[model samples]
Target: MEVNPLNIFFVKSDSKGDRLLFRYPYTTENKDESKQKKYGRHNPYAINSTEDLLQNPQSQTSNICKGQLSGFTDEMLSTLFAVKAELCNRKFELKVNDVRFVGHPTLLPYRTNKDDTATMILINIVFALQASASHSVVKCYYDLSKRLGKALRHEEKRCSYLTEEMKIMLAAHDEVSVLDSEMNGDNDDDDDNLRHSVSSATYSSENGADSSPKSAFHLILQRSSLARSMKSVFEELSSTGIVQVRINKWVLLSFCLPHKAHQIHNRGLIIEPETIDKCLQKLRPYHGILLMVNPNELLASIPLDSSSALLRLIKLYSPLKSLQTLAIEADLTLKQVSQLTGHLVYWAKATVIYPLCESNVYVVAPGANVHINSPLVEEFAKEFPGLCLLQ
Candidate 1:
């Protein structure tokens, strides 16, 4: 299943107020052009286009323009900040119209150089998903956000990585503001130099080049390890189910979307050791084993030490041979073979059955699906061309 996030935002709060530290896919200069194409000029939230709101007053209160931070309005930001106490140290889901905000708010204790005591800082890494997202997909993104939040908290506690990165981001924000003002004035030469510096810094940072502190403001922000991590989490986890990111160049953290319970039902099975042992002991030497799954697939998941033995067992396995004879041929003790069979059964890889004999009675399993329209019927017909399933 595809689990793509519309946008990602890192919000931080302290005694001052809530601040949007950084967001992925930075707001471009052509935001207005793209906004028109995406939401159309009729969107109430579109930049400088108020006709939609004037025409439909209800939409002004209900609908939000889509794309990046366009949907994230001041009202939503205030609501999030007002519930800071409830949002801290827990998972939060805030829905506004068609957008759903999911995040794990983490509270970290930070200390400054002058002060020996620590102050609490609330940080949340949020993913914006469509409200129509499936429960499983939402859960996956939530898990990813939770892991990322915890990792940042750990890094902040260990080395003040988050604190330092935020400072750099704030500085970059200030630099952008100054540049905007300068560009507004008639200084064509200065504007060209600033543009060149921004592009060069961005390219250098993206290519893993070491950028100095005095580099362009864009470089300072994108050069942050935390920023790169946020980008990686959004892009990688959405495309693939797994993500591995290095934190502050010191620790490597890995997170993955867990498989649903039904996909790994055998792993969840609980059987008493006494019952398993009794079942193993009751197995007759004349009984044969049948593999339910491909041996090659099982070999990939099993340990290397046991893989060779398993392969040998598969090569020697035969429904016509007694358990004792099969074990002898496979160069395995009868007890060892019985133990192996028990493990396979526990994993739902194989099952024990009687050898083929005319005297043996066969019947459909009680839980088997006997419907004529069942896919099993088609498979059976394909396997046996002339056989009549009803007969």
Candidate 2:
């Protein structure tokens, strides 16, 4: 099953006064001050912009019960519980400073010590669940436009830096998505991240809703915001725990694609048989690409673009082909090959020949062609015979 990217926020209460400092970029939009003061009996404070959490981190005496937290819907809690249960069942071992899954080095300061905060709790949850699960990991996707609008009012320079960081993050995610499709051939079909406003709101409702006594007094968040990046969120969460720390040294580098990338990182149109035929008809006037389809030989059609070296690579493609093998055949780096394959699979709607075994020597087709007597592969071969299959 596919899991949507997880968004977790940690807020610390102000030690100095009744006001709370938002460790995360909490939203103040769609909130009416006067009406809230009249109906809710209190005026909502503007989101705190201070970066230093130590100045006023939440303490035991802090009044966090006064609607400081929100967005804890039943669905979200159920998912979190399910994740936790799975980790326990698997007996997955995790430590507070475990940095195996996290890409950024300096983004995490708990490597040497521990901090008693919601940030540590959520991080452990995300990391342990990811380690235990086979097909999901937590991800953060931000909407730059909305974030800039909110940040511009408070800090211009910080907003500018954030913009650049987001660009790099998006690019990195896209790259990972492409690589995942090529390697795993898994189809991720959920679009939970891009749906709706994706914002969590704070609400104070009646008592009978939760099992915990504190639930009635605690603030409830409905959803998460797209205004802050994962890095930003983590930084703020650790603000109180770590002192005088600068996250400038942390930089995200290219890494192995996660299991969730295949579904979320799709591009190009999935062509139907009729559409394939129409594309073939358009290509009838050309002679460079040849089309041949045969199932008896256990080989699909040979639809090779006559002029493209990349197409030639696919025609003779095998996952077993080493870097040396590729180099001997064509002057292409691994990155170049990966980029080309990404275009072919995602943009061209090519079939991926997934490995059926651990050694990757045995291979099988997609679920649509799982059964031996299934006609899907033959029909697929007939439509566009020379299309490349990812292995």
Candidate 3:
């Protein structure tokens, strides 16, 4: 997904007329005339979902337009426009190119989530919606979705955007987990260990009743260098062939192949094609309806040169798919699609369902997708750590 900065404008009116002056801090030019022709005035970067339009009417305009936009609080909005008008009156440079001025989005609605994990997940979704570029938001969402899956231990709903149902589910899941732990006589250490092992980030103690999750998310986001962090994670995985996982953080960085496991340390664990099939059998009841996993993450991997062809293929068969079926739908030889799935299946990168080691088939967990609770999945997570589930 792309992360383009939106434009900002100052609207001024005198007795004679009204004038609109603008500045764009984050703008990208499409060098290819043909590509530009494809989108024209319509910026294809933004996804115009109904949820988006309802929340913010100004979102109807392209990010290139600079009057008013979403993702800003009322105070920030007033202050920014005031600054723009002042700058215009003084004939100073009216265009500000920095992201520093952009404030956090509205927080009250999303803070309804019961805990920090759910709250953070919701904030990330709002950020994705308000973010400028598509790819960057995609990356952000991809990582957040993984965190959500781990935190809630659910596969049916990964992306917890403005959806109220997900919030309720997450709260309920938390309650049930607590109840189960208490009933099972699990101690605080056990709970802490489980949370520590899976969480992406440690919850800050400073989050009081008055404090906002939206603000907390923005703080972490601002402090974070996501692109650099992503690059480092990618490089570390590529070079060392070792994936270190610390949940609640964006970079769990898990990736390993079946053959590669031997190079590291052997747990005497061997996953055959049949083992994968059995796992699929277990997961079939829940998530087998889909052909492919998360297409956004899969499509994120395709290079710009091959993206069009890959995207065409993805559109044709981007659903719950087995390797053989996808090959037929994509009109590609089985060998080609198999190779594609192999690259994508790493560390649950683009998947909602667990993938067989180096296979094109995928399956969602019956409840939480973690391997620790299930004998089969626990075996996988133990072996792979941060990547594919063991079961």
Candidate 4:
């Protein structure tokens, strides 16, 4: 059914001017007279959507213009102008330009005629109306679009001014683990490790009523860097559990936090490795999740007592194996990653999920459609293969 375009503008409350909307559809038309003949403001306007935006496309305009334009909102104005535009060409909707943010709406219809034109036009009473370049919804949409465009350009300029490090880190946050053209260095570790290390800088005490599981992990890593290195890592891990594990460059220096074993014995996260001979054992029957918040102490090679804890970690892990959502921080060798992965399948038995990695892209975008360009994580994916399948 072809409804009069004017009906779209004049709603039930026309006298009150409850509706005020502005719309303009633009097509790229060359200013050159020669080219203009080939491509005038006709079909394929070079816009993404041609259909009427059911909800306000210029929602900000609608919101800003409501009750402000001669008491009409942007929506109402759009309807009115759409009707007027269709009047001349049923298929044509007026596309205006140069509109802007109005602190207070000004209904400056640019229609030409005597002032008496508006006075005579009572929907029931037929007559012409005076107008101006800035009067109708067509003009309003044009003006608003221009204003929005300028604001967007300003924002792009501001983002472009970001420091190189900020740009890299922020961009790296997206497309984190995917191997792509941006990668440049040797990827010795997996994306899982890269994401953890990069994300570590963002931790803060949040406002959740209870400390979330994520916070627990983040808080642990936020400890002093000493606690992150292998020697100190063992020192910190023991405080959390009874196994006082020691580490060396190639192997561990010690294992079993002799002081905390009773606690682990109490909690059953592990079966305390009480003796040098018994502790040298490789497996245990302990049960629970081994939340390896930071494994800087996890040496390249396992020490004697280390086996007992590893066994306990494994035994405790059997049930948690189904939770393969593993997260690790710190650069590690493929060999080191292999040891950890082996245990996940052999012990925890969990299916890994979510790839977390790094991006090395230069910028998110100038103003919009911004995306990430993680480089480190991408390297890890390429270097380590399926190691980060669960990242």
TM-score of each: 0.53, 0.25, 0.21, 0.14
Where's the lowest-lDDT run of ten residues in candidate 2? 103-112
Model 4 backbone overlap count: 61
List model 1 lDDT by residue over 1-391, tens digit each.
Answer: 2245777778778787777776665545343454457555465665773465547454433332454445454335544633466657676787777767788788888765456467888878888777766676676677777877787788888878888888877666656554444434534686667774784465545646643223233454565778887788767655543466777876666664433211232343333334545777789888888777666775665544454656777778777777888889989888878878876764445668888777878888666667877777777789799885756
Question: Candidate 4, 369: how far from true, in Å?
Answer: 48
Highest lDDT among the candidates is held by which one? 1
- Candidate 3: clashing residue pairs, number: 28
Deviating ranges (above 4 Å) for candidate 3: 1-293, 307-309, 318-322, 350-391
Alpha-carbon lDDT of model 2: 0.30
Tell me the whole-model lDDT of each prediction, alpha carbons only.
0.65, 0.30, 0.36, 0.29
Best by TM-score: 1
Tell me the deviation in Å of residue 225 in model 1: 0.6
| Cα RMSD, model 2 | 21.5
User: Model 3, 334-383: lDDT tens per residue?
Assistant: 55654444434332333324323455655664554454565757566675
The TM-score, computed over Cα atoms with residue i paired to residue i, of candidate 2 is 0.25
- Candidate 2 stretches greater than 4 Å from native: 1-4, 8-159, 163-257, 261-324, 331-379, 382-391
